[model samples]
Target: MRRFLASALFLSSALPVLAAESKGGFPPFNASTFAGQLFWLALTFGTLYLLMSRVALPRVGAILADREAKIESSLAQASKAQAAAEVEAQGLEQALAKAKANAQAIAQEARSKSAREIDAKRSAVEKELAAKMIAAEASINETKTKAMANVEDIARDAVSAIIEQLSGKAPTAAAVTKAINAARGE
Candidate 1:
């Protein structure tokens, strides 16, 4: 293809040189003289035109028709290639869409599963906390009961010693009860 283009360029450049040579230093054509230079110029042009139309023009036209056919065939092939490419692109797009949808579904499922697991763990933690709180409260109450029992014994001993110091002897049970009740105002 490159060689053909180069040769056509060379031939086109040579055409003007050939024309200049054909008319180089030719005598001026006289239009007034019949059967002279003007007549000969006209006859030469008519003969050349007739020869070109009958022989050269037909061959040139055939060559042009063949070139046009080749160009049309190349265009049709390119169109088919483009259509095939478009079809492939559409298929790839559909596949990509399906893949994206599948990925989204998988992600949603994973999120839901994780949420359920976290909720279950939270529930377990809350139950354990409630049990621990109840146990702590029970321990506190037991400690309070033991401490209150020890306080009663200490109070009795202190009061007896005080009665002994004040009256020079320990108080009797009845007197102790009356003192305790009076101290309590009941």
Candidate 2:
């Protein structure tokens, strides 16, 4: 850097001498200062190259490297977060599926239990009704027997009365019973 500064100061000092050597034409196009122009052009280009290579380029390269590292780091973090989210989602889905299965099992078990209870109750009710029906049938049969007996007695009395009125005689018990039995197709 100090060498570049020394050369630039030397060129600045020599500028007036090169201008004086020009034959009053455009300074860059004048043949008289051609060698000086080439010298100064080379010096300026070399100084700019040295400045860019030694200072500006290294700073820019460092900045670019930092930016790349930041980008990679950010991407890695994002991928890790995405993977974690996927794992959590899978866990949640599994939990939900398990819960659903449990709920269905509970519902099925409850339904079976309720069905069993209902069947037991139905069987009990059926048995009770059957017993009541049997008792009712027996009572009906008894009533029918009693009514038939009373009807037979009434029939015998009516027949005896009718005969006594018609022929002035009463029917005997055995004759009336035999007649009733014969008329019944017994």
Candidate 3:
């Protein structure tokens, strides 16, 4: 605070000297001071240019180059990952197709095997039924032959009884046999 007050007192005391020396509307527009102003402006501008070129610009350029290198590396990694993913997807598709084909083949083989089994069973059943039918026919023919043989005896006894009842006498067996044979068209 004391320093500030001393500086302010000095400036106030110098202000009158500055005002008496200056007949300025603006000092920069005064032709008489132009050469000195031009000299200071050139010196300051050259100094700023040198500082930017030697220090600040190179640092900014290095930072930009690093950022660009990181971006390029990231892009390259992304492309490699994408390519690997595509290759894996293609491999999966091929595997899936192979699996589907195998499944179809298995199903077809099973169907044919089942059909063959069914046909075998059907043939066995048909053969059994045919044998049973043959046996049944043979039995019926045997029963019919026995019944035919007994019919002759039954006719002979009936004829003998009728003759005895009509004429009070029985017919001989040979005569009855001849008559039965004649009636039967044998």
Q: Rank the candidates by lDDT, best first.
A: 2, 3, 1
Q: Model 3 clash tally? A: 0
Question: In model 1, what are the clashing residue pairs, if there are any?
Answer: none
lDDT of 3 by residue, 52-157 (tens): 9999999999999999999999999999999999999999999999999999999999999999999999999999999999999999899899888888789899
Clashing pairs in 3: none
Tens-place lDDT digits, model 2, residues 117-152? 999999999999999999999999999999999998
- What is the C-alpha local distance difference test score of candidate 2? 0.92
State the TM-score for model 3: 0.61
Cα RMSD (angstroms) for every candidate in the order listed: 14.8, 9.7, 8.1
Q: Which one wins by TM-score: 1 or 3? A: 3
- C-alpha lDDT (0 to 100) for residue 112 of candidate 1: 100
Model 3: residues >4 Å from true position, as ranges? 1-62
Off by over 4 Å in 2: 1-70
Give TM per candidate: 0.51, 0.56, 0.61
TM-score of model number 1: 0.51
* Cα displacement (Å) at residue 178, model 2: 3.1
Worst 10 residues of 2 by lDDT: 21-30
